[model samples]
Target: MAPRRLDLARFAGPTAEFARYLRTETVGGFVLLAATAAALLWANSPWHGAYEAVRDLRVGPHALHLDLTLAQWATDGLLAVFFFVVGLELKRELVIGELSRPRQALLPVAAALGGMIVPAGVALLVGRGAPGMEQAWAIPVATDIAFALGVLALAGTALPTTARVFLLGLAVVDDLGAILLIAVVFSTGIALLALGAVVVLAGLYWMLQRRRVTSPWLYVPIALATWVAMHEAGVHATIAGVLLGLLTRVRADPGESEAPAVRLEHRLQPWSAGLCVPLFALFAAGVPVNGEALRAVVTEPLGQAVAAGLILGKVVGIFGAVLLVVWLTPASRPRGLSWPDVLAVAMLGGVGFTVSLLMAELSLDGADVLTAKAAVLLASAVAALLAAALLVLRSRSHRRAGSRHTDG
Candidate 1:
């Protein structure tokens, strides 16, 4: 029994170490955002017609009938990959990240909860009972960790490691809240038969897991079918990504074999983060905003709400909640992260990308809501810029402070 346990530990050690290395060296999220920015610029450029034409272009077999505009393919199809990655991250954090411990999770969880609550409240206040605007409340609740953390990663080594971990945890909790809100608030009318199909598919997935079907290919068709059924069933299709990711395996028990989900997540990480996310960003993060549209953004209620919620509410809410947690719970602050570092992270929280875009689709009028979307894009850009700037400043400040202390 002891020999078996020792052997199992030896096998699992390398896998866990690899997972940590991936987390530490993550560049996919930032690369995706950068690609997304370029796409947005191109879509709104003089070649806007070409951009639209490419998205609307279609090619597929009659039997498959897979015809989608470039945008739809990116949003509806590729984003499943993005959501899948999100699920893996969420699982990892729950298993080993900041949320691994109940006590360690409390601060970020509280901060995320407050961040979600206050932004929606602010959006409601500003929406002023406008028709269809209530649905927009959840728009502000998400924190784009990739964009946010990418901004912080720019600060290099000036920031404390704990601060980044804290932000990462906070963002994960924020995403979980966003997922729940989507399930409850944003879900459209349901199709019972399609939902039943989804349930059956879920059962099949579990059975496969029980039977130890470890090959990822076995689940691919099932996952694809689940996404299609979800789309047909009127659930936001991205939830399929989350569900499928959860269904994947992690490491096995100490003395048992490695879990298939963990193996799958590890295998899929490169593709999901490296390929799917970047492709999705490149296609989805574009809006053809002209000079006229820019002017209209100020008056557009949807635009105003998204802009305010992401830009102002994110930083204000995160910072305030962090402070409140520290005040209420002694020892809440992580060692080596001064208030300034916390402030820098709060600023990075303003970069709302994935959830922001998703919410824009759900809440905004689209086509007609072009102005509002332009507003969202513009606001997101501004927030990213501001957040990056603040992180840079904080980095310098921390370095200078360290130098002075050393001299003293």
Candidate 2:
């Protein structure tokens, strides 16, 4: 028999309620977008100097080569936390989730590759002779999981689980590719000693997991040391976070309800989504959006390439890739995903906010960086709006279809 709940229970559970809300992609998305808006406003407001001063303010132990601007901390330090969350998710998916099967994973792998290749080609073709074209071409080759999934949650409520998984898997693979590029392309000359330390520390982390050690005290310091080593090696510190996350044990023990990886991810996800990512945006998304910047983005070849790669290339690359694979091979679109749904996801892929901003900072300099960032913001905004509209229409279509079936 069911027991009646006491009225006092309702008042006792708001913390759980608040936590539940924070777990949603909708809340995370809106938080990130709000931070971005606030950043832009503050940067363009009368107190613009404060924004720059705060962002450029450096605070770290210079002896360990850790002294860096606050903005750099957000990018290299905090974003690492976000990527660690991503790595845990990817590991789970590969082991037991949607990507467990080679057959099921092929579609997203193809989509990710196509999503990357076509955008690079588009950027290259358009910005061939531009100053930073060599590296800037890779900017739009990545996707922002938070923004994309958030937009989906808001507009794609009626969409099937298959669609969400596809997008999630695609973005994960896309981020992996971008991480590889950062390691290979954007890095300065490597310090072999620091590189060796990173490898050793990461290996030690794996050994700790194998031994069933679960102390945060030990892991946190090692992780921090690994981050510093990676930075010293001229590789991005975020890569260290991903490597550590991947090394963490995900399978539960006999008496455990959740694996260590799962436990850590659950605890860290809220921080990553609600604070780490938003703070990154607060520092990174403060690019000037004045007429001059907008004009440069629209008129300059480099800016056009970035905008086109994100807005046009993503749609064509992703959608066309799915069609080609499904038509030419044994792969088929996931069940319940229609052509319109695919198109909407393709557009959402263009909402390349986080990594695109990182890429802009990494690849360009001075005015070029400013212009590229402005283009990223503009393109992301347009893509989100268009994708939202299409998703809403698709949602209505789904409702009508469901209604007809029920009536039948």
Candidate 3:
């Protein structure tokens, strides 16, 4: 019993540390933004050719079909680590956090559905008859977790904790929706043997977790194999990370100090946030914003459609969905959030990054690719600025109300 008590005390330390890490992710957000700015500047400068050269430089084993460009490595390889952390966090939320309740979970799930559907509709309507309109509609359907959460941390620190949790849950669901869309829309066809291997490996990992097997040496190889299998299966390798995270046992076993999910999240989150995500941004966000690119974005239906979907569509979709859910269903609105807070966060959902770029690459070609990327960048920037203003206003209002209460 005494030993168990000591283990419990130790477990609490990492749990607390994980929460602190989540709060300080603002720093990682800033780092990511800095990398993005640098990429843009370097991409536009005289050294632009060198930047492209480095980005396009390819290396890796050819036999396994692993050879890919530096940019592809950043997106396909490094971002997997980031998504693994996201998976862990999301599973935790489902198990113990705001999303644990069925009623509470419904809100974000509905909002995510709305966020995706409305944007697709908006893009389709606006980009009607345009080249690539068929697939490019998905470009504005994602909300970047890192960028949205970071901006919230910067602008809404004084707001209630529930608002943050709501946004986190919403963003996680939103990204998952985007990933599923990629799977269905872009997949050439799955490699059945490799996918089957991933299923078997993931099952073994789960069995081992349940049996409380704790050897990194054994797990590391299996995890790597799962990732490889997923890649070979013609699905995004990052899905492997999410699958493993969900399979990991989040509950601590008897006499165990910490849950496996919590422990792994604490250790891997720093690497994901500090290194993997920022590197992904550096490589992925280097779209040209020159006069020609800007002109294409503004003058073309594709660009106008994406911008509208992000700025106007996200707001209407998210906010309207929340209201509809509250009025029409038994799902309880998340506490500590008001209509204003919801609206502000809804606006923040418009700042789609990361996945939007991938959609553009997958869906468009030639100068149209550049045009789509430029639209994404410009639209996301506008969304971020608008969300920031609303968030700041809400934070100040919350603070002033708190002050009056204290004085009374």
Candidate 4:
């Protein structure tokens, strides 16, 4: 008998969804790079002072203490849009995607946890005794999904589907960990009244979602109120986005084409990828590189820790965690996923661009912030290069093996 053909429908939902996600992220990665390049050029140009002026320009109602600079708006306000999408994706995965099954989810979750803890530990060790550096530990714990997926996309058909799924699951969990750190570690000056208002709004949102209220007008105001309340409560406003996203109903009603979460994610993905993320990159990635600034980035403890934590810490932590899990439970390793593949993905996990920049801004100030930003950019670039090289090799190896099997 001929070898039985593998059924495709069993994997259709997740595979198709992941493919769509990767395509959007790949395109967004190019846009993000262009924005970063423009920001750098503008910052270093003769009109650099004008760039700073634009970034520092304040707006909003001063009486409410809501007046914020252009850069602050980019980091705080625009990033919330990005996180909202993240929340949707996370909920979908938990409910119906790769993470729905405990066996399938365990490896990536373990990897994500290790990816976070080890980098933080390394950062803390590297920044030991340095004043004000403790807060910067979270900087390297992020993995920029767009950049990592874009690099993997470059491998084209040679890459394995299993590898892509693994990376996506790992990156999603990594983002979740980063968000938790932001909410718990970075928040300050708790305003109980404002927080209580946020809680009430969240409860209302959840009730509406459970009731299957799909009107955007009704939900939009609630989301805005929640965001404002969270901002006033000294928590990052983006946390509100995640909460709203999580509360979105993922299961579609009868005769519906898609769930509320899927519909919203599809509709908002373009805005998140094309506009929100790139715009944030434009504001966040522009660092005035001068001789003095370069020297500080090189010599500063904060900068060194961030760079080292991202490049070395992520690879060691993620890969080591995978090895440990596989050793402890041999059956836990997913079929067709190899050690080399895990290693390559671990390297990709070190590309902590978007969230890392946000964390640096929140954790440091003045020159330290600039130094940390520079370090994040440098580390992300290095990680991308390393990951790309490893993925290319792995792709070629897979292609050759496929040819041999087919010829047989």
Q: In terms of TM-score, which candidate is strongest?
A: 2
Model 4 Cα lDDT, one tens digit per residue, 1-408: 000011233335774555354335567688889999999999999998999999999998898777999898888888898899899889988999889999889899889888999998998998777666779999999998888888887853486677778888888799889889999989999999999999999999999988888788999999989988999999998999998989889889999877898777766666777778888999999997777777776788887889889999999999998889888974365567678877988999889989999999889888788898898998899999999899888888888999999999
lDDT of 1 by residue, 299-325 (tens): 766667767877788778888988998
Candidate 4, position 262, lDDT = 73
Q: Is candidate 2 or candidate 4 better by lDDT?
A: 2
Better of 1 and 4 by TM-score: 4
- Kindly report which residue stretches of model 1 are placed more than 4 angstroms away from their true locations once superposed: 1-26, 58-67, 255-262
lDDT of 3 by residue, 1-408 (tens): 000001223335776555445336476667778888988998888899999999999999999898999988887788777767767776777788657888778999899889999998999999999999999999999887677877888999898988877787787678678768877787766999999999999999999998899999988999989988999998888778878887888788789867998788767766776677778778877878878889888889999899989998998999999999999998767787789999999998888877788788778888788888888889989999999999999999999999999999
Ranking by lDDT: 2, 4, 3, 1
Candidate 3, pairs of clashing residues: none
**lDDT of every model, 2 decimals:** 0.71, 0.86, 0.82, 0.84
Q: How many pairs collide in each candidate, listed in order?
A: 7, 0, 0, 0
Worst 10 residues of 4 by lDDT: 1-10
Q: Per-residue lDDT tens digits of candidate 2, residues 1-408?
A: 000011222334776455456667777788999999999999999999999999999999999888999999999999999888877877777787667899988899888888999989999998889999999998888888788888888898898888887887788778778888887889998999999999999999999999999888999999999999999999888898888878888789899877987777767777887888899999999998899999999999999999999999888899989999999999999889998899998899899898999999999999999989999999989999999999999999999999999999
Q: What is the lDDT, from 0 to 100, of the residue 170 in candidate 1?
A: 86
Judged by lDDT, which candidate is best? 2
In order of TM-score, best first, we have 2, 4, 3, 1
- Which of candidates 1 and 3 is the stronger one according to TM-score? 3
Query: What is the TM-score (0 to 1) of candidate 2?
Result: 0.95
For model 4, the superposed segments whose C-alpha errors exceed 4 Å read 1-23
